[model samples]
Target: MTADNALPDCVALRIGLAARALPDTTPAELVRVLIAVLGQPLTEAKLNTLKVKDLKTGANGALSEIDDMAALRQALQCLHGEDDTAAQAAVPTPQPDAEGRLPNSIQVACASNSGERLDGHFGSCARFLIYQVSATEARLVAVRPAPATTRLSIDHSAERVKLIDDCDLLCVLSIGGPAAARVVNSGIHPFKRSQPEDVALLLGDLQTMLAGKPPPWLAKRLGRATGERPPQPSEVAS
Candidate 1:
């Protein structure tokens, strides 16, 4: 469902204000706010599929079932306070190595709706399949689930970008301009594919790239892995 359809007018207004007030708020934090406001535990899968109307319907439905308006109001106030505290807290940024080369065994994050294919868009994936790759091998590292809802705000995009901040590359079917910019700013390269591909096939291709002389980006990453200096700007340009 779209963001516009997912929430009631009042609920949407409240969330919009909170989001605007806290421009750096995380997607997980927004999910918590929705949970509090809606009075229900919404799953990431369900939230992913909801449009704005759907969100509104869900919020209205939940409110209709609740007989205690005071209780609901109190719960929302508590949640808003928690969000404020979280927004004000400092978040540590990841630093590049002394040599400024990408790591040897690079971490790559693939956007997938299911676990098997690289089909999801960068901004709206159901999950991210992470892999640790070296010149000779690739291994599955972790699977990060998407938040319950996609807010599509810059703050939400920043939060999602942070989720894979450790990674060197992001593979997805498509990515919006804003989302792509955020990913690059976080020091992750965004790779877009025209169609979904098998995860194994993609990994095999990556292994080949690593085994051979990689492109500029991968070369730099390989330099980090092997303790060699990355190519200078002039060298890369040549």
Candidate 2:
């Protein structure tokens, strides 16, 4: 079923407000935060795809009837709280590192000027924005979306792709192979892993490339393959 029929109108409005307010934020980022904060239901009972028929029930009245008008008050309440938290988590100022590099995980690219762009990939939306750079490389980061105060206007998929297509870097924690392939094929790299250790390793590799220094380990691998230097660390920054 379409979201219009699945989701109530008030939910749509809340989502719209948040989407419109993100200026440079993407729907993926919002969904990331939303999922992080809201979480999913943990019922062990799995619903079957096939519909069940009540063959034994009396014909006078169906065993169950649709009550589409039932209030979605509870879902709306959850959305409202989550939206607030997500909004506060999205402030875009870069924090400092000892070497003055804006941690590699958050870094977009090295600019001639003192500025850089950061990409935040949340569920269904890919948010990209340039922030005043305080160092050579700023770490790309992702924050969860806030709970909704009102409603959602649309589903997350289309909105996310729109933002990703227009974004510079594709930073995300978890995405399927198909989606990952899309981002890579589009000439955007995906940060599939987002742990601190992974981010540090990624940053170190990128920094080495940026400085034109190839690590022996990487050089060996690349030599065996194409006799060319591996993708520069700056590639990740980009």
lDDT on C-alpha atoms for all candidate structures? 0.56, 0.34
Compare the candidates by TM-score and give the number of the best one.
1
TM-score of each: 0.54, 0.37
lDDT of 1 by residue, 56-133 (tens): 234344324334444344334423443334223322222333544334677888876554677566655556888777
State the TM-score for model 1: 0.54
Model 2 residue 196 CA deviation in Å: 6.7
Tell me the tens digit of each residue's lDDT in model 2 across 1-238.
2212322344444443343333222333333334333343211121111112211121322222322212122223323533444333334443443454332222232111011212222342223432212124534333223222222354443334444442334444345565555555543455444421333344455455545644553333223234244433223222
